[model samples]
Target: ANNPIWLIRNGELQSFGPDKQPIGTHGGEQNPFTLHEMQLEKGDCLYLFTDGYADQFGGSKGKKFKYKQLQELLLSVHKQSADEQRRRLDETIENWKGGLEQIDDILIIGIRIL
Candidate 1:
């Protein structure tokens, strides 16, 4: 998954992660993964995910769902509880996929600080 990290801080939705590598192998360019630090306020949320969902081939034209739509979905669900957001995300993907078989493993984690 190219896009592995996302954050909603201070009512803004932003994406963060390394550009050269994936979860392992250190991207070949470096010996170790680069780390980032950010300050979070109350009610802030963090998200980490793999590319399965966005890479899915579906929709009217039968193309990949892509990352843009997924980002919009996350922003829209920002007002909801974590569990409800999860449900809506699952529902959206399932509906998008329709009867087609799922092709890859999809993983998403949502963390909100109160």
Candidate 2:
């Protein structure tokens, strides 16, 4: 599976580094993780997150949140301050999850280029 890191700059969202799986002992053989290098300018927002956010099941139809929708959600909030972005993301997912039990661990790291 390709795991992508999300980037937002000038109100546009870009995908990068469909990197390998998570670093863990579950793999059959030990493999080095891929290295991704990118130059970021001021105002650029970068997000690294686990699949839990997208894999969560919710909404009216009780469907997975999906990556596309996550991308859009991040794009919509990337310009906000880090605290605000965190709040919005948390609120959005909570609202989306509703009363469903969380199925996986969720982790998201956001960095704003300075």
Candidate 3:
């Protein structure tokens, strides 16, 4: 499965990076990993995260949290202090999870360009 990497740059939330094809040492001719390059402006925020966050089963219908919703959530809180942003993200996901055990590890990094 080709999952996209989410990113936020200069107040714009977007997703890019990583090819959908699986990587293996065995018998299939697979696409090589793409080399992505980007420039960061002062105060820009960049995020690198695992699929677990978006794939979480939660919300009103116990559906996946989703990339779009995640994007919106981050956008709304991007202007807050870095620590505050992290806290909010954690709190939001935890509430959404509603005490369910997540199958995968949740790892998200938010970098603010200076």
TM-score of each: 0.87, 0.89, 0.81
Which residue pairs come into collision in candidate 3?
2-20
Candidate 2 deviates by what RMSD? 1.7
**What is the C-alpha lDDT profile of model 3 across 1-114, one tens digit per residue?**
356655666678777756767655657786668877876678777777778889998776788898788889989888799899989999999889886778677877787777
What is the lDDT ranking, best to worst? 2, 1, 3
Candidate 1 lowest-lDDT run of ten: 23-32
Candidate 2 worst ten-residue window by lDDT: 18-27
Q: Is candidate 1 or 3 superior in lDDT?
A: 1
Angstrom error at residue 109, model 2: 0.5
Candidate 3 stretches with Cα past 4 Å from truth are 22-27
For 20-57, candidate 2 gives per-residue lDDT tens digits of 65565574765677777888999998888888999999
Model 1: clashing residue pairs?
A: none
Query: Among these predicted structures, which one has the highest TM-score?
Result: 2
User: Residue 26 in candidate 2 has what lDDT?
Assistant: 73
lDDT of each model, Cα atoms only? 0.82, 0.86, 0.79
Instruction: Please list the residue runs of candidate 2 whose C-alpha ends up more than 4 Å from where it truly belongs after superposition.
Output: none
Give the higher-TM-score candidate: 1 or 3: 1
